[model samples]
Target chain A: MIPVEYMSVILMIVFGFVGMARKFPRELGATVAYTAMLFALAVFGERLGRIVYGLLYRGNPEAAPDLALVQWFVILAFIGAWVVMVYAGQTLSFAGKWPPNAVTGLVFDMLIGLFNGWIVVWTAWQYTHRLGYPQQALGWFVPPLSERASRWVALAPLELIPDGQEPWVLGGFLAFLVFLRVVR
Target chain B: MILSLQHELNKLAFAVLRPVLGGPNPAITPPTGASTGAGVGIDGQVVATAIPMLGADLSAATLVLVGLAAAIGFVRGVRREAITLMVAAAASLIVGWMWPAVASLVNRLWRMFHFAVIERGILAENPMAAWGEAQASAPLLPLGGDAAAWQIGFFVFGLLILGYGATRYVAAPPPKARGIRGFSVLLERVVGAMVGALTGILVSRFVLPRLVPNAQVALLGPGTSLYDRLAPYAPTTILGIVLLLILFGVTGIGGGKPRQKMYQ
Candidate 1:
């Protein structure tokens, strides 16, 4: 039996490849494959947890998780970031009459990604367990901007604030690169 | 702000599903008409953690299978890639649900293969260890009852929406182009394999050990730490990345184009 984490990724790759092989040969196929794998894993995640949980409890299937706000935020963030990155890449790289340099496009998107990272980390800091902790750890500036703003809801509830998942963003950008490489 | 948010949502849907609709080499040319609802933000919460908290059961293999099936239509003279993908997605979803074990088996085999090639020193260090940290910290959902049902329903719905939207909005490529198909296929596999192998080593050597120390338990148990227990497995991980690259590269070349048949 393989370890669960590996199982998850492998599952992703297999489904991803299969999806790619099918009708949607591009990123869409990979996305569906990824989605499918994620769905399957979501279903069996707890069952896999039995590797850890079985020692203590009988591991009833009933004990799973409710979609928490944090979880939702993360999911939305990944999908959002992925989409933004790809679109941005497409717009900058291909939207105009002339195609931009692929390298330039890649760099341009990386900068945008960095900007996004800054914003997410900054936003996350306002509500993190320790307000300035995550920021200081990363060495960034976060002025009150407004003392009154601090008193008010930072933007929304902590859960509601988008947490800017970076991997998905990067994935989108890379997907663009992959797409470009394939099409060009 | 609200408008921007909506726009982002539209983009997210498009970004996430674009790959499914377009294939690796999506047509870059603008669509003939302006498609409505162009949001771009994916719900980060879905895939942030090692485990998908919400709907995300389809494995990479299943994803690939769906793509291949969809591709088969294109190869057979199907013009509407979107519809082909949509059908393939549905078919693959059912197939994946029915044979979860098969998905799991494929995952294991790939991991093993990924570990093998990397261990031989073909690429940077494999990062299977990072997977541990990724898993340890990866997001988890708290869906109490009916994990299967909830996940299945969500998966189907998302795919359907994606299918409908893609078919409706995206345009097909102009005429048959020679060599483009062959070129894109090779590129996708090579890139996928390279990224997989390099990341595998990085995770094992640097990321995993730090984030999720090797031990018998997460906090405290008879053993030291989760990482410690996993230390032995590090070498095995390196091997997997290499093998994964080889396998994907080989398989990619063998895999043909998508079917061109559109909405039949």
Candidate 2:
């Protein structure tokens, strides 16, 4: 229900604390999953959005979904699915020679949590902005975004990655993560 | 490497801030010096396009950079980081609080020493001349050739390193025990890093604001650069980091304890 700008601003710190609590394993798992989701969305989100919108239109003849909004909602669903999977007993759990203690591991975890928070909060912003900052969505009342919130949104992290290069960038990042995992 | 990354980020921030602040876009020509709150540099060239944006960036970046110290500290060892943090905080607070007085004293001493060396030129020729030469080329740094800031930075850090060395060797000398050199040593290093980082943050928090202007602190509010947005997160993030150290230390997990000496 909070404004995306306000929520996104604080989310990273919240995630940092969450990282401290979750330690390494769960946090890394979530990070990997989120990064993968970002990659998948970058690669196929538009195509999938068009397809889904077309199908919904064909099936009901009056669905009338905004394609961008649908895609963002789809992204939200994907995020939700991955969120469940990550928390669902270490589906993408990382394992190996663990760190020396909880605190040391938690440092990395906190960083990872902050990283995830940046992505997740941005996705939330995407959906909310696409919807034109309404006071409600579905049956829930959401807080309205301020006039200046959109300007601040332009400064959020990860949005500056050049367009038409997201797949390659995210793909390379995924590859690097795998390389790091293999080596270390 | 880090500076370059920060530069790229700054460029991006500047692009957004340009329109927001009503500054001339670098891409196109403006109608001749449209008073965009820009400043002229040392070489009589236009320096920052918009000083407030840069100020905000600087404030945010400084805070983030200081927070990064905590990350380094955690990776090293909490205890070591703590000691380092204490030493650094002490040194920086001293330097920041007493800089005016210290600068005057130093100038007086240098004047007296310079006069003495000149008077005793036959005995103190090369050493004094060499020292003078070393002081001459005080190169420019990030905050627009603010050599005073650099001097303060170096002075505080030098004191902390010396303080840390004293604590390590004099206050708590390590016993020469083989095969026990493990995570404890590692923990010591990480703790050192954490302390160093926290100290940097402390300096940034307590001392940096005084050095910067109101415009810089304005970004610390909200609706600014990414760094600015996250600037306020320092307290919670630091709390999380410190609490993790304490919680994990108490739990005795992560092999925090050194491996028992098999050889001994």
Q: Which candidate has the highest TM-score of all?
A: 2
Candidate 1 lDDT score at position B28? 27
- What docking class should model 1 receive? incorrect
Reference-based lDDT, residue A94, model 2: 44
Q: Model 1: how large is the Cα RMSD against the reference?
A: 29.3
DockQ category of candidate 2: incorrect
lDDT tens digits, residue span A67-108, model 2:
566765665677677666666644444444344433334445
Write one digit per residue (lDDT tens) for candidate 1, span A55-145: 4345654663322323333443544464445333432221111102222122223322332233233333333422332333333434433
Name the runs in model 1 displaced over 4 angstroms. Answer: A1-184, B1-148, B160-185, B188-264
Fraction of native contacts, model 2: 0.06
